[model samples]
Target chain A: MIRFDRVSKRYPPGVDALSDISFEVAEREMVLVSGHSGAGKSTLLKLIAAVEKSTGGAVLVGGQNVSGLARAALPYLRRRIGMVFQDQKLLFDRNAFENVMLPLSITGFPRREAAQRVRAALDKVGLSSREKALPVMLSGGEQQRLAIARAVVGRPKLLLADEPTAHLDADTAADVARIFKEFNHVGVTVLIATYAGDLFPGARRLQLEHGKLLP
Target chain B: MTAWLAQHGDAVRLAMRRLASAPVNSLLYLLAIGVALALPAGGQMLLANALSLAGTTSAVPHISVFMAANADRGMAAEIESRLKKRGDIKRVQFLPREETLARMKANPGLRDVIEALAANPFPDAFVLAVADERPEAMERLAVELRQLPRVEHVQLDSAWVRRLDALLQLGRTAVLVLGVLLSAGLIAISFSIIRMQVLTHRTEIEVSGLLGATDGFIRRPFLYYGLLLGLGGGIVAWLLVGAAALWLRAPLGELVRLYDLTLVLQTPGTRDSALLLAFAAGLGWLGAIISLQQHLRKS
Candidate 1:
């Protein structure tokens, strides 16, 4: 669950990234944030993840005030939230399996348990056979799927994906949407930021324009 | 506890893998650290042997108590016997004036000078070897001997010993300063290498940060990396010192024999080696920690 009350983020030299934004997402809810470039979607996700502090008001995730969280406590708060960026930030030096296992490894899961979960996550992302392949060897669509698998491998309470399917084809995009729905059905709150509004039909949509939530 | 150990094991394995990924670079770093460490460690070994040799040789500080020229042989005997009874005196030998003159005549260059003297100017003396060769100890013995009625003068061979001690002290200070400077350089080198590693993995680090990885989790492998480098450097330094000692052992033994002294060249012992290894490792860890702070702040 996430709640934002008049949260604002302002950069140096008079640039407003997010201005008085307010929103709420219930437990296990699936919501798509549709916004154009510079619409503060990324900033909003960062606030929830505690990656960046909000300039004004409060942002809460899992009932803890994220805006006022201490630096030492940020990691623990982040552990329960999964985030995906558009860059696909996969470590190419390692194989696909290693990339997917990063989240679970960070949490210090046992070796055998990590391996099994990594395999299961890969299989779920349709990357079971490509576990040994490097990120450089994977196609764009497969890379995005790998990122998704990594984001959810730790079974985080909330998932925040920024333009996850931006570079994928229609079929791959729909496949990604199906994965999100599958996760939401099992009580994992999911928030996706993308400009394509039709990607997730029947899902709640929160539109933002120039850092403000649209009515 | 088991899980914590398992995590550390994983970190160590991962660090090894990371190091192996760039063999040439890692080896070069290790060599730099080894050479820096070897200088002081090697110097310490050599200086220890030299100091021990200086202690064992004729450089042992002693006092010579000279009796009055008119003093009888009975007085010299009395002094020798009295000195022999003291626990601080390791040995006391009486040298009669006639015997001293005869011994001087045996020296080819001193014969003419000795024969030219009108009277046997040499006086009855006692040569004392003290258990403690410290300047103060020798001076104390000399002061006590000077108080004797028949004694003309008490000469303590302390000046030369004092000079040698001063030189040895200077050598120790030099070694210490060298050690400190080299260690600082080693830490700096390790810091640079770790900073580069972090830069290379910048994206991965940021991603992990976003994935809820703790700062300690991110820093674990680099810390291990620093520790491994330090340990490797320590081993290399020890080997270099050992090899040098091995090469010099026989020659040094011959020199010691020529000087009529007992001293043996030795490599570092277990405790010394462990200390070097642990110190190097600690430096590496410190460097990695410093770099981690800088890089993590940015992330």
Candidate 2:
């Protein structure tokens, strides 16, 4: 669950990334934050994740004010929410399985259990066969799938994805969208930020333009 | 507990793998640390052996009490008896004027000079071995002996011992200063190595941080790397010092033989070796921590 109350973010030299944004998403709800490039979609996601602090107003996740959270406490908060970046952020040096295993490793999951969970997540993302292949060796779609597997492997309650289907084929994008839907169907709350709102039809859309949210 | 150990085990394995990836570079770094640490460690070993030799060669200090030239054998006997009765004096040997003259005449260089003298000019004397070898104690004993009747002078025969002790003390201090400076150099080397490693793995570190990795988790592998490097260097240093000691033993033995001293060149003992390794490892860990703090704070 996430709530933003009149949140505003300003970069140095007086550039506004997000302005007077107020929104709320209930638990187990999958919401699409539709925005053009530089429309504050990424900034909103970052605020919820506490990756960056809000310049003004309160940003709450799971009834906790993340805007005021201490830096030392950020890691614990992040562990509860999985993030899939636009760039994939998959370590190219490691194989697909190791990439997916990273989150479990961070949490110190038991080796046997972590391996099983990683395999299952890979299977869910249709990356089970390419688990041993490095990211550079994999196709673009497969890399995105590997990143998704890594994000979901830890079984985080809330999932945040930024442009998850960017630079992919139409069919591949549909497949990626289907995986997010499947996760939401299983009661995992998901927030996806994308310019291509058509990929996620029928989902509640919060559109943003020029750092301001549209009604 | 098992999970904690598993995490640490994973970190250590990762560190080892990273080190193995660059074997030549790692070996060169280890050699640098080894040579630096060996300098002071080897000096300390030699100094210790020298001190031990000095102690063994002069275990007891001696004092010479010379009787007046006019004093007779009866006065010499009385003074020797008095010295032998003292608890502080371990042993006293009386040298009569005739015996002294005859002993001096036996020396080739002194024989011609002694034969020129018409009469026995040497005085009766007593050589005393004292229990306390401290300079102050020896001086006090000499002053006491000089006050005896028929005694012309008392000489404390430990000036050379005191000089050797002072020189050895200076050597120890020099070694200590060298060790401290070299330790700083070792720490700087570790810091630079870790800094480069962190920069090389910058992307990986950022990804790890984003994936809910704690600072400790990110720092664990680098710390282990530093610790391993230091430990390996310590091993190399210990070997180098040991080998040097072995190589120098025969030469040192010949040199000491000239002075009638059975000095042995000794390698560092087990406890000292362990301490060196531990100290090196600690420095490596400290370097890693400092480097991580600088970069991790920026992230």
Instruction: Give me the candidate number with maximum DockQ.
Output: 2
- What is candidate 1's DockQ? 0.71
Candidate 1 C-alpha RMSD relative to the actual structure: 2.9
lDDT of 2 by residue, B108-177 (tens): 9999998998889899888888888789998998998889998998988788888887899999999999
For B1-299, candidate 1 gives per-residue lDDT tens digits of 76688878978998899899999998988899999999999988888877876877667676888999998978777777888889999998788889989999999999999899899999988888889887887787788889988999999877887887898999899889999999999889889989998988888888878887788888998999999988888888999999999998999898878867766798887887888899999999998998888876785
Model 1 CA deviation exceeding 4 Å by range: B58-60, B77-92, B97-122, B129-133, B140-144, B147-150, B158-160
lDDT of 2 at A179: 99
Q: Which pairs clash inside model 2?
A: none
TM-score of each: 0.91, 0.95
Cα lDDT of model 2 by residue, A78-184, tens digit? 99999999898888778999999998988999999999999999999998888899999999999899999999999999999999999999999999999999999
- Per-candidate Cα lDDT values, in order, are 0.88, 0.91
Query: Could you give candidate 1's per-residue lDDT for residues A1-215 as a string of tens digits?
Result: 89999999999987998998888999989899988998988888888998889999899988899989987788788879877777888999989999988887788888798899999988988999999999999998889999988888888889999998898899989888788888888899999998876988878998999999998
The reply for model 2, stretches above 4 Å from the true place, is B84-91, B97-122
> Lowest-lDDT window of 10 residues in candidate 1 chain A?
A79-88
Q: Which candidate is the best by TM-score?
A: 2
